[model samples]
Target: MSWTERQRALLGAMGLRVWGETAPEHALATSDAGLEDAAAPASPSDPDPAPPRPAAPERRRAPAPQADAASPPPRASPAIDLGAVAAMEWPALREAVAACRACDLCQTRTQTVFGVGHARAHWMVVGEAPGEQEDRQGEPFVGAAGQLLDRMLAALQLSRADDGDAASRVYIANTLKCRPPRNRNPSAEELHACEPFLVRQIELLRPRIILAMGRFAVQALLRSDEPVGKLRGRVHRYQGVPLVVTYHPAYLLRNLPDKARAWEDLCLAAGVAEAAAEAAG
Candidate 1:
């Protein structure tokens, strides 16, 4: 239990002491050897450091090309043959009308209300079809609606005067020449069958403006599903002539509030008519 022996016991517990009765230098040398053994290099079987990761592949983007400014313009379709129709005499046209049966409406019609107005009219008003009153009268507008229309025309300073120029100044027609049962709307088949006559009448009269009154009339002319509320107040073109859509007199009769809007539309139509007449003059 001496100081040296106590030092040796402490070093032995730490596994750095040599079990031998030796000198201080020998013991120090043995302790150095023990420390070297504890610090020996690890085995070759241990895992190696992971290899350096390869860089991500570069993404090749396709370049955007510029549009060609020198491309040729698109070609348009041939214009409709309106001249051939314009050359047809009124008597010949009337004869053609007399023998027409293009639609089922022809079967029920009392007479072909072909149209009434100036043959060379600048303003043409087209309605949906003849009603009970019109069928009985052989005219397009002769009922309460017709009376309203007459008043409307008079307001615009025009009339049914078959005088030389007047006869050629105001024309009227319908989408269908015949009256549907019970004043109902004309069917698509009826409208399709009768549309050619209207087209022909427009071509012959060469009206500067067409007033399409009512939803049916607007739809037939524009071939669109848009409601009359949306269709009215704006000017549209049909077969080179301007078309102004307005509420039918019959509809205005039932809906008094809409009369104000209808009046504005009538004014628009009148303005168009006046402009056309002035241009023609």
Candidate 2:
């Protein structure tokens, strides 16, 4: 593609080449006779004659490596009491998660993202892990991806609010409480350490239908490594609760065409939730 003069100048400033454009050639050739005449004139006029020598090329050393704001997790982590984690109530669990040092993730996270939404909602959403925004705010699902999820849940007449009706409310949590540094995938040890908190939350809420978003959430719940496409069409079970798998909102943002499939997953989950509510009523 061709660029305008201003555009090319800007690209040059940024050290990026404009694609498909030929580089302009520079000519720096000087004749030996011209240099000899010029030097002869200078030498005749000088009292102390000395030959001119070229200056040595400047030496540039590479800059030192600066550290990133979020450092990698330490290799070792402190142990957590599974029994204590399982027995804690919502308030206690939130405090415990906030103070947890159970895994290496705890070392790098800005804060722990425990969960958000109603205490006993019929619909629950479980995602993979805390990301940059979630870690900063200490709330699961709190950015662009969260916005899309809100739109999806809104279409289903459900929300992530503490005051909505039980059937219209949705509780959201992550497989891992603390975010991995640089938003990298959560390690198995990190997931294992955080599992009890999620288990206790699910046990307490006992949602009619659980929406498992992203690969790790699916694998953590269903113990299956299958891709979401292969697992989403039908209902599955998790802790005796109906579970539906679907691509994560973040993934859907990148792959817009798969939104229809996500809608289908939502509908399937909705039907399962409706069925469960009716059975209870």
Candidate 3:
């Protein structure tokens, strides 16, 4: 019934019992020094108390500075010249592309397809590289897949031509200017070799929107390894222009199920293009 009696009974149930003649509360309050002495059964002549420990020094932190409203703004990098690139004539540019031996892809390609479409179109479509048809025709997106792309553009009310120019309303190019052997995907080396030309093309065209068709084009443009499934249905940035990646028309034609997703991507791309055009106007 008493607390100590109950505690002893509880401990005894577990094959243990309270020890020492000290009162329960006094025993509980006893300093660790007492426990040490009790454990060793020290002689009464021993020092009655242990030496005290020195206190730890307090740590101090520096005060934070007050906010200043008149602080100067951080400097920015120099602005890039995207429009100046348009002044570069196609003839000279094409000549340079044709002469490029930057990568091994140049060794096998029949010819360079230095993009085709309106020079100043609001939209640019970047592909992986030229295929057999593109290499032979010296134009990007001109094969069966190209035909589907044309239809896709038509559906969006975008032409491959400018109002006065006979060229299409969209500019199309590849990550690689030249076709890889057997239509294989362009290697990183080939893409690197051809990237500068594409960058220049983007600078010159200054398209408001870029539609990177397929994974290779997306990877080259975005410098990402995320799958096209993850890349699609979102707007990304490429050299400051909005980019919407989707399945290549070639892929869409092969996997009919993906046609709906491709259509959605085109709609998003068209919306960006329309907004850019409106802003320009």
Best prediction by lDDT: 2
- Candidate 1 lDDT over residue span 34-60, tens digit each: 221111233366253222322322333
**Candidate 2, residue 212: how far the Cα is off, in Å:** 0.2
Q: Extract clashing residue pairs from model 3.
A: 159-169, 160-167, 160-168, 160-169, 161-167, 161-168, 161-169
Residues 26-78, candidate 3, lDDT per residue (tens digit)?
22222223222111333567544222322322323213333676865222211
Q: By the lDDT metric, which is better: model 1 or model 3?
A: 3
Of the pair 2 and 3, which is ahead by TM-score?
Answer: 2
Give the Å shift of residue 219 in candidate 1: 1.6
Candidate with top TM-score is 2
Model 1 bad stretches (over 4 Å): 1-87, 164-168
Worst 10 residues of 2 by lDDT: 25-34
TM-scores, each model vs. reference: 0.66, 0.73, 0.66
Q: Please give the lDDT score at residue 89 for candidate 2.
A: 90
Clash list (residue pairs), candidate 1 = 118-167
